[model samples]
Target: MTLTGVTVQGRLNLSQQHLAHGLLFRDCHFDDGVDLRGAVCEELIQFVGCELNDLHADNIIARKGFSVVDCQLRRVSFASAQITEDLRLSKSRLSHEVDHVALHGPNMVIEKSLRLDETWITGEVRIPFSHVGQDLDLRSAHLDNGAGLALDATSVIVGGQLRGDDGFTARGEIRLCWGRMSSISFRAAELHKPGGVALRADSIHVSLGCYLDQGLTASGTVRLVGAQIDGELACTASTFTSASGAAIEAERLVAKDVYLDRGFRADGVVRLVGAQLARQLTCTGGHFENPAGDALDLTGITCTGSVYLNQDPQHEQCFHAHGRVQMCGASIGESLVCSSGLFEFPGGVALDADGLNAVGDVRLNQGFRAVGRVRLSRATIGRQLDCGASSFVSTENPALDLTGLVGHGDVLLTSGFRAAGQVRMRDADVSRDVDLSTAHLEGTGTKVFDAFGLRVGGTFTFQLAQPPKAEVDVRFADVRRLNDSPSSWPTRQTSMEGLTYQSVSNIPCSGRIEILQGTKAFSLQPYRQLGKVYREASKTKEEREVLIAGLRDYRNRGKLKWPQRMWNLFLEHTVGYGYRLWRPFVIALALVVLNFPIYHTAEHHNLMESVGAKESQEHHNVKHCPTDFPCFNPLAYSIQLFIPVSNLHEVDKWVPDATRGWWSTFLLGWTWLMIIIGWLLAAALGAGLSQAVRRQ
Candidate 1:
């Protein structure tokens, strides 16, 4: 039956009817609505260029298909309908302002595809529990339900792809929660539901992949919580903007690969916490801007391949972020390259990757810049951590924090790296060299570089362009070799206590001594280590000089009582801390030469007398010499007094005549002083010789 250019004033109720032939209507107008409840049609039911108030086809069976092309309808319902062939509703205008549901297809089963191409829907299109065998294409469809749900395909199953690409537009939320589709594509689509959810596909499973890329724009949040995509989830060149909340929320999502790169922009937070990716997560040349909150959060994510947050090589565009990019507790199978990326979160953390575990190298170098702190504390890197040519600035916190990090390869902070705040790497363990050569670190009245308790397997280079502005703490740090320059040493304050190094670079002994002296606190270990290094190199002269300088400095700087201080002073002047071997002997010769003149002058004044003829008053000079003893020679007397263990009898013959005058008395006292000085000189000389021998 076919009707054209006809108008029916009353309702056409075809309930419980069975028709073998198809029904076709063209240019027809119905004032009421048509009801096909429980109707069975063996052929096609087509409506072309028709205007109807409502079409209720509940529990209807169509063996061939159902078409509503280029039609204007207030409401359409195919609830629980079973259609063996395709259901085409192309180029239709459906508006239900009172009921707010333009098309309702709950529990509907279609054996073939359901096409809504170029359709205009002003109310909700509810299709919960619907199943389609083939494609459910909505290409070029415009769905507008104001701020309400535009399309709700909850629990709907699509055997083929669910496409809404090529100029598809939706004004309200489009939900596909718990839906199972072969694949989903929204390329070149625009979804606008500002300040509310634009797309909610929670727990949806896609067999092939999901594409929201290539000029796709969403004005509200796009949530994909617990979604499972067997293939990649691509969002390349897509734009998502949320006024107050997250732009993309994909927590616990599982996908093979995730691409949010190449002109992808998110105005709010893009959270992917606990997401698992089988392959790479590429975000090259992406822009994430959330000034008050986190821009991109990937906490606890596990990726099988590398994560690229770097710049685009083809376009020379950098991956820029205005808020924090948090990846804490993330595990990556390969490297994490963020080279040439710019992250700015002033006075807060810019890139926080604390406790991250990556199997390959982590490259934050090559012009990478962060306006706030970049924390990687307790991270485990399998390969090198290259931060060369990077710039970090944080006024309130550490610029780069890598505390307790364990890295297997070299940690390079060299090559024009600049940090305006403290760079802390305390307790870090690196297998290879940690080079900071040519780097500049500026601090805000705190430690510039704090690496206390750090352990390095290779050399540590501190040959910076200039000395840091603040203190540097390396207490208890152990390195294989130390390569530093005097000009680069922190001049203001430094803490190097318990620092151990196997070897040092080529620096003068005096310069090395100055380094030890420049420490904020005094420790004897550095001096001993320096001396041992010189000794191993067979530089005896330099070693002696270092040892002497150490002793002098210790006496002056070390806390001690007056008695101990005096004893140290005496030892230093007498023997040069046992390093100057000829000091004591030279002093002994001068003492003997000066005292000879005093004895000879006493003899000429007749102040000397013989001890054997004391009562007879005989002078102890050469003229009145005693025959029993050696001649009373003034030279022999002077020499004998100096010798503490001599067997000469000169002292037994000579005596200062105290009975003659006061000059004789003075000579007697001087003789006694000489004997005591001789004993002290002999003891000091013996001690000095023993020390020198032991050192040899």
Candidate 2:
């Protein structure tokens, strides 16, 4: 009991001091508090360089270690203390004008470790429910509870690590709420409480890693709500500044890896909603500046790996998430790499990962630049969804809301991808190929690639895209093949009625009506899907010239002037476009040899008289037939007007009498135009013999 240079006045009662031999107090000067109430100090309890004004150790029972090294305590109560070994207040200096609790340890039981290296406390350092068996080191600690709570370890139970890293300094609010730590090194801690909560570990249960890494300078709110971190919850190169709300409120955190990126800088909201990260979430060089709201809110976060908001082209470093980086129903196992990032929320919704379920690919490709509304609606991507050279900028709605997206693979907005507005993929289920070749899709509002009921397995490429100003409504999309053409889709800005693409690679059948100009009518399913892509490119006469020009523009839809569209294209090339039974019997045998030379040059009499009429009545002797009529064959009245059921007695002997009165109107207009070409060649040979008897 060496008390050198002693000056102890009152209240120095070590109530139950069973000190065998250790109690040295050098340069001692205790004016008041030194009451180790009910003390049972067995061995060492040295207060070197002591000037202890108050150190009321309530229920103290220091069996072995306790040294207030360079002591200058005004008030320090280790309440319910029972330190067995190490509890060194290294380089200690605690102040208390009126004793606002310097280091009041509640339920203290430090068996092994608890060092406050370079310690200097002003007030408030209550270690609640304390049981520090191993590490509770406060390296270079300097707590100044000016604005309240410098360090209140709520349910402190740190067996291994809880080091307020290296240069730890807390002006206020560093309360480790419900603490139960193993590893929690605040690398360069300088937690400042502005709007509250500099670092409140809510339901804290850290088994390992939880370093607020490199030069951590927190302003407010670093509350890890329901935290259960086994490893990695680092805030590398951290510089968090909370304005009002969340500057990192890990909602339901159950972490593995969750670094707020390299040179992380968050202004406000960095809330990981329902966090369950078992792996990577590295925001390469994160800089989240909340414009108005949501600057990195991982809604239902469940990241297995890769969620790096990329821009790390070897640390060119830029994940400048201005605002709204909400991962809606997040479930990313692999890639959510926001390559070359800058997803600014102008109106709102910059990177809303709607129902996002990515097993692997969701890389917002190369030069990613989303202004607003990049909603991946109903997202379910197992593989490829690389937005190649991304640059989506929403006007009002549908900037890039891939509605009901279910991509098993390839769904890239290829090469130089750029969307202005409407890119709503309605009922998407793209298993493969949806590469908008050189993408530049823009629709401002109505339709750019609305893609209703979209389902592409492969090849739905809008080859070398640069056209889309608007209007590309893939109505009921079931696309298989269609690498666009006709100037890469400009059929009046495109609207594939009920898009059912089968095949169509280049599609420019030598200006087929300038690719069917604006198709107001004649929708024979897009010329039968461009005649099945010209019959799969075998091009049987360009697939019968685009299915007979889509059957004469659907039989001259309406208002067909220009001589009724040239008499419906001469009844569609002599009716093959209709039924073609040897093309109306070879145009009714060439209209019976051109109406037998126009009824033998319009003969003035003789409808039909003698084929063998009583052997021509003995060579036209006119015996019994003279009173009736004579013969002026003209190929027997042109076979009775081109044989409309013609067992004709020379077709009732036609007469063009009266001095050829214009040959009786030119033989009555050649027997009514050969009786309407023999009833349209017997109704197009009875509809091609009932379509060849129903194809046998």
Candidate 3:
């Protein structure tokens, strides 16, 4: 039956009717509505240029297809309807003022496509639990539900692509929760909900891919939480703006790859916490602006390929984030690069990748700037962590924190890298070199570079652009080799105690001494470590110098008792702490030469007498020789008195007499003092000779 320019006064109810031919209404106006409840049509049922109050097609079955093209309706209900072919509602205007839903299509199954191209709906288009065999095309469609859901396709399964691109606009939320589609594309679509969710695709499974890119704009949150996409989830050149909350919440979303790059912008947070991606996550040239909170949060996300938050070379623009860009606990299969990107979160963490595990290099270098702290604490990087030429500026906290990081390759913070606050790498273990050459580090706290307990498998290059103004703590850190300049060493407030290194760069012993002395506290370990390095290199002279300096410093600066201080001083001056073995012999020879004059003066004053002729009370001179005893020679007497084990017997013949005069009394005390001095000198000589023998 075909009706043209016909007017129906009452309801045209076709309930429980079976029609062999399709019904076509052209330019028809119905006063009430058309009801096709429980009706079965063998051919196509079409409505063209028709004006109706409602179209209730509940439980209707169309064998060919269903079409409502270029129609004006207040409400349309196709609940539990089955269409064998395409259901076309193109260029239709559905305005339901009383009801919240303009088109209700729950449990509707379409054999082919569901095209709503250029259609305008004032109320919600509720199509929950619907199944479409082919594409669900909503191109150039306008949906307006005020603040309510504009399009709710929950649990709807589309066998083909679901496209809402090319001027498709939804004023309220467009939900696709629990829906499964082969692919989804919202390119150039505008979804606006202001403070509410604009696009909620929670747990939606897209077999091929999902594209919300190509100038797509979402004013409110675009949530894809628990969504699984077999292919890439790209939002390139898209804009997401949420003033209150996250712009894109994709927690636990599993996708092949994610692209939010090339002029992509998010006004609020773009949270992808716990998201799993089979490939890379590229955010290059994207601008994320959430000043009060995190801008892009990828916490616990796993991506099999590299993550690029760097500059787009073609556009010469970087991935700029105003708030914190957190990637904490993320496991990346390849490198995490943010080269030439600007992350500004002033006073807070700008880029936090703590606990991040990356299989390849992490490049935050090449003009990458973080206004706040860049924390990579506990992160494990498989390849080099190159932060060369990067600038991290934080006034209140550490500028760059790499604590507990395990890096398999070199960590380069070199080549004009600047850190305004402290750069802490405490407990970090790097398998290769950690280069900080030409880097500028300024501390906000006491320590400038705190690498305490850090272990480096290769050389640690600390050749900075300038000396750190604050303390540099490397206490207990184990480094294979150290390449640093003496001028780069912090003059004071350095804590290098227990820091172990196999070798150091070629510097003077005095320069190395300055390093040990520049430590905040006096520790013997620093001295011993320096000495060990010199010893290992077989530089015995430098080793002795270092050891002697260490002893002197310990005596002067270290805590000691008065006796210990005295003993330390004695050992240092006498034998250079047993390093100078010939010093004692020189002192013994000088003492013997000075004692010769004292014995001669005593004999000249008649204060000396032969020991055998003591009863005769005679002075022992060369002229007064005793036959039974040895000759009373002054030189022989002095030699015998000075030598403790000499058998000259001159001391037996001649001795100082104290009973002669006052001068004689002083001479008698001096002669006995010489005997005691002789034994001490002999003992010192024996010790020096014994030390030399042991060394040989």
RMSD of each: 3.0, 13.9, 2.6
Candidate 2 vs candidate 3, lDDT winner: 3
- Among these predictions, the greatest TM-score belongs to 3
> Can you write out model 3's per-residue Cα lDDT over 1-696, one digit (the tens) per residue?
899999999999998899899899999999999999899999999999999999999899999999999999999999999999998999999988522989989999999999999999999999999999999999999999988999989999999999999899999999999999999999999999999999999999999999999999999999999999999999999999998899999999999999999999999999999999998999999999999999999999999999999999999989999999989999999999899999999989999998999999999999999999899999999999999998889987678899999999999999998998999999999999999999898774888899999999999999999888888999999999999888677776888989999999988999999888877888888888888898899998998899789888899889999988986787676767678866766775676678678767766666676665655655445556655656666677767765888888777667666788778788778778878766765665565556557645
* lDDT for 466 (candidate 2): 65
lDDT of 1 by residue, 133-160 (tens): 9999899999999999999999999999
* Model 2 per-residue lDDT tens digits across residues 588-678: 6777778787667554334322333444444442123443455466676666665577755555544444344665666666677677877
Q: How many clashes would you count in candidate 3? A: 2
TM-score of predicted structure 1: 0.93
Give every collision pair in model 1.
Answer: none
How well does candidate 3 score on lDDT at residue 602? 68
